[model samples]
Target: MSDIAAPRSSSRARNLKGGGRNRSGQTNFELYSWLFMRLSGLALVVLVLGHLFTNLMLGDGINGLDFAFVAGKWASPLWQVWDLLMLWLAMLHGTNGMRTIINDYAEKDQTRFWLKALLLTASIVIVVLGTLVIFTFDPCLDPHSTLSVCQ
Candidate 1:
């Protein structure tokens, strides 16, 4: 039998030459968002694992986790800031990933715009509320927990 060459993928060949070029110049937003996703994901790996290790492994494990534990953690400004960073990074990372999905799948321009707007608004609210809770939390609020150290 005569040797034959493998068939090539014409679609991929065309795409390699910028076959999908759009009607406008490319924006850097997607590039930056993609980079952010990778970097934030990496940082989250460390932050989340460290948090788990401290709260669940370094101490009495899960049994040590309670309202008082949380209060005690938050009482230290360092831990509070760490939690705040985690909250912001997670929300932003997840929201950006969702935005990429919506941009990919949404058909109508108006629909995409509205959905993204809502997502942004909700993210903002949650981030603000979570940050406020972290900084403004009072461990002495509960009457039954008067023996707590914060009281």
Candidate 2:
């Protein structure tokens, strides 16, 4: 038998590099994205906890939640702004996380492009609709409403 040995394959050979490097070579976008995820996650924890505490722990708790309860909360400018920030941050964080997942998992260029396009479109639509709902909300807009709060 021959004494020659077969060459070993490297794990590095199977490792795939992502398109995380900026093509224009102008900025470390991936690094920023990484940092954003960490910071935003921390902020989200606080924001979400505060939101839950305010909505569920204060006053009558979850049992007091209703359309009028929501209207009362939104009537306050402070609550409106708080909710807006929460909405924007949560949507952006979720969208960015999904983008990273798609970039890492989708191998086909066309597939990746289309998937990202769909994600971006959905994100924009949700953000826009949510913002509109938050800002344009009117609890008394109904003319035939029966709720005393609406009156």
Please, what are the lDDT tens digits per residue for candidate 1 over residues 1-151? 4676545665445545564442243445677888999999999998889898998898799999888888889879889888999999999999998899999999999999999999999999999999899878888778767545844
Candidate 2, which segments miss by more than 4 Å at Cα? 1-26, 146-150
Candidate 2 per-residue C-alpha lDDT over 46-79 given as tens digits, one digit per residue, 9 for 90 to 100: 8899999988999999999988888888989989
Query: What is the alpha-carbon lDDT of model 1 when measured against the actual structure?
Result: 0.85
Residue 144's lDDT within candidate 2 is 83
Off by over 4 Å in 1: 1-26, 58-63
Q: For candidate 2, what is the lDDT?
A: 0.85
